[model samples]
Target: MSIEVGSKLQGKVTGITNFGAFVELQGGSTGLVHISEVADNYVKDINEHLTVGEEVTVKVINVGKDGKIGLSIKKAKDNPNPKSGRHKSNPKNNRNGGGDRTESFEAKMNRFLKDSEDRLASLKKQTESKRGGRGAKKG
Candidate 1:
């Protein structure tokens, strides 16, 4: 069977790499599901989600002129509110499968200010230590 763009097919995960996973689709065609297309959250590691020999349903995102195929497992239909324009929430963002409001702007601003001050102080100390607790001595 010829694989076309936007087609959904079941495939076996033949290989898993840091960048993406290789899936063997129907008709012996192999496609890559990029790390970013594996999920909506930060996929620092792809192994955490899939492994070799796993069967997955993937949508064909692209069919290159050179016969390369691109697959995606994180399409809209796979998650809730696919048309909401919001990314599928990561587990850390939800509690018990329920929506949870994140920190407000004021709270975020306060935290940013505190963190910035700490970083600035640390830099100043580093500079002072290198200069014997004063400005850099002139040559």
Candidate 2:
């Protein structure tokens, strides 16, 4: 079967590597399912999700001119509960979420300056404590 972009097909996992998994598609063609495309969440290891000789449904994301096919297992599965992967600014939790709210330019600048000063002071205190205060020597 000819592999086309945006087509979903079942394939056998032929090989597994640190970067991705090689899938044997229909018509004796092999494709790569990159680690990032393995799941919606972060995939630290490909082995955790795929195994050799296992059959999985993958979506044809790209077909290169050099006959290299890019597939995504996550895209193939229909997500019943879709959650926003990106950070959405919630107006209700402005203080807790640290989200941008309607504020004047001067007010924002003041807040930023205060935050920066606080962080710097905390870092200095940590360093001082680590070094056993100023002009302290290691024994």
Candidate 3:
């Protein structure tokens, strides 16, 4: 079978590592399903999701010129679980309005100026104190 990007195929998990799982595709070719592509949720451990010799459906996500194949098990599923750790609530409806509000150019410039002035003043104060309050030290 010709393996092309976006093609879905069944493969046997030949090896498992911390980074990813290696699978032998239908045509005796091997592909790697990255740990992040193992599941829709965060996969801290690949072993928890795949085992050696197990069969799994994987979508060909990439095929490098070097003959390395990149697969995604999550994308092969009919209905992948929604991404975890993402709140379902809309941020725009939140009190901060989802941080969509933009600062006007003038406002941003003013804030920057104020911050720069404050930093400069603090630096000047530190330098003055270090030099014995600005006046030359008495011998």
State the weakest 10-residue window (summed lDDT) of model 3: 92-101
lDDT of each: 0.84, 0.89, 0.88
Candidate with more favorable, higher lDDT: 2 or 3: 2
Superposition error at 66 for model 2 (Å):
1.0
- For model 3, state the Cα shift of residue 57 in Å: 0.7
lDDT per residue (tens digit) for residues 3-110 in model 1? 878888999999998899999988998999999888766688999999999999999999999999999988724564454435544778553356425768897678
> How does each model score on TM-score?
0.59, 0.75, 0.65
lDDT of 1: 0.84
Give me the candidate number with maximum TM-score: 2
Tens-digit lDDT string for candidate 2 (30-138): 9999999888778898888899999999999999999999999989997723664335446675763665556788988898899999999999999999878988877
Model 1: residue 90 alpha-carbon error in angstroms: 15
Q: How high is the lDDT of residue 135 in model 2?
A: 80
Rank candidates by TM-score, best first.
Answer: 2, 3, 1
The better-scoring model by lDDT among 1 and 3 is 3
Query: What TM value does model 2 have?
Result: 0.75
